[model samples]
Target: MPAHLPHGSRASAACLSPVPWVWPVPGCLSQGAISFQFARPAPPWPAMPPQAQPADAGRRVMLMSLTGLVLGCAVPLSGKRQSQSAWLRPPGAVPEEQFLARCVGCGACLSVCPTGALQPILSSSRLDALFSPQLVPRLGPCAPDCTACGGACFSGAIARFAVEHKPRLRIGVAVIDQARCLPWAEGQRCVVCVDACPPQCGAIQLRPIAPGQFRPVIEPSRCPGCGIREYRCPLPGQAAIRVVP
Candidate 1:
């Protein structure tokens, strides 16, 4: 396990390419289309100079302002979010900037993970998280038995997890989403999630979901956030899921 983060200082990998640059057009005219002026012979009737048209001037000013706004909105975006973790970077993983620079925004980990711990976030606050990933434990817990993300990560965020000594990671604690769970919903005899957890140092244990029936309850102290430092995840595809920052 790494160091415990302070309250405000902490919050939240994969890689991605750069966005094309967009700039304002030279003229302040509207996006498209133009109006035509009627051609006429020299004005024979009016020998005096023409009067100033404040209204037309104002309209042109308005149009120019609008043109600037449209151009501003059209500017292309820059770098995108990543899906892996910072700590996972190994000794010779590709150059951090270069690797992140070209990664496309596709979530292979989330799709293949068994426990459904991985989730796509809207933004990344720092350089490390750019294009990397976040773990949403509330949504699901990390799988304790397997380290599929390690093997499946093309970017090596989780790296190739060769089930070595138990990992000491402490990503976050689990909180059930009663909405999607079977025991919480039907209130019947079911321990699917608990039965699913690995036995040794179980991150999750069974407790009373109802008066008679029991449901898997997370044991924070024992859980290593998907066995990154332990081995207790209980999901088939993903290790029990986590919402690691």
Candidate 2:
């Protein structure tokens, strides 16, 4: 037998219900919309070992390779600035001080170079030459007839000139190394250098040394230093005839 509970009391409501009474703890009421939670259990944490860490060796290797690739490309692009003393500016280039001040490094000349002779100087040690345009004779010579680079320069650093007027432009003077020249050193009859000089320039003059042999001479006054002779020199490796700044 059970005793009767008081009216309007919690014990009275429990006693009236068909289900058995349970303590009002967290998540204890499953059928109601209201969730009256006083306490909650912590979630299980994921396992981690003390020895587990990032792979230092793999990360280091990747970093080194990326650095090497960047420097390797930069060597050709800007590392050659050490030789800038011998670097010749494009034809119609303004005076050195004025050119440096006006050049915007737009690389317009690099785009229109038909012979790919014009190259932009990137990453120079000197701020004046950085990203400026220069001529690379080993690749090819500035064609006597081509005035594309001059026209591309809108900054006035490189003054635009007519193609017919290029003959009067003097970029540099070619210097001959007698020690490496085939005609002067080996006494070989090589007229390649003289023959390659621009027509009507009279930049390269040949003097007869022996029968069927002649030594090439550069007339500083007449030579425009176009570097065509250096590019066509018969010598291997470095050209016997090179343009000087």
Candidate 3:
């Protein structure tokens, strides 16, 4: 340098200069210098033409939409199948498919049940059936004269019908387990189920099986599946009679 430069003048000049510079390596002062080239700002990179979308972009979008639609439809169908065999619906309830479609999962039916037999299905494998009303015989029996549930249902899931029609409505069928029934299993004189049968529905009848002994027999045609027999059964742990859908 012919004259001493101001402090940082070299760095400042390096920033302004267009020429390449030679800088000394800090620890290799006697060895050599490192050369750095100042590359001309690459002719301001040509504005890349906006890339065209893939030819199948629209197709891909449409396929995704269709897949979503199919999944949406499949979920309800799968739910219906899973819930088909789950619970016994209340009296006057429509067919399973129609009932599921019409039911809003409102607790109207459960609230109006006099016997507390109509309980809300709190949990189910299928989300669609949740909160819907189901007749739980163990909790209580469906009263034969009650039409409250059907009247309470604003949705047509439970059809509105007269109280007299309750006896004719086959919500489900009652089946007696011979092995568990007191008369059949233990040879005891038990007419409790027969006596508990709805007055209007003489569905359970006493049949003389042996000397001075009788067993309860269910006549499916006359049985409205009111579940009174099961509810009133004297046996402990799982009623000898059960109503099935």
Cα lDDT of model 1 by residue, 1-245, tens digit = 22222245322201111211211222212433122122333665868888876678788899999996665334322344344444333212244454454334366666776766566654644433344545554445565555665566675444455454344544544455555455655665555556555576577766764467876567777655542321233333433333232
Model 1: residues with Cα > 4 Å off, grouped in runs = 1-40, 44-106, 127-131, 164-169, 174-197, 203-221, 227-245
Per-residue alpha-carbon lDDT of model 2 for 1-245, expressed as tens digits?
22233344243232333322322323324444233322333447865558867779988999999997787556545743342344689999987767866888888988998888778787655555677888878778989889998888899988899988887888888899999998889887788987898777978888987777778888888888777888888677899999888
Instruction: Report the error of model 3 at residue 122, Å.
Output: 2.5
Local distance difference test scores for all models: 0.47, 0.75, 0.77
- Stretches of model 3 off by over 4 angstroms after superposition: 1-73, 79-85
Error of 3 at 147 (Å): 0.8
Question: lDDT order of candidates, best first?
Answer: 3, 2, 1
Clashes of 2: 0
Question: 97 in model 3: Cα distance from truth in Å?
Answer: 0.5
Q: Per-candidate TM vs. native?
A: 0.36, 0.65, 0.68
Instruction: Predict model 2's lDDT versus the native.
Output: 0.75
**Among all windows of ten consecutive residues in candidate 3, which has the lowest summed lDDT?**
16-25
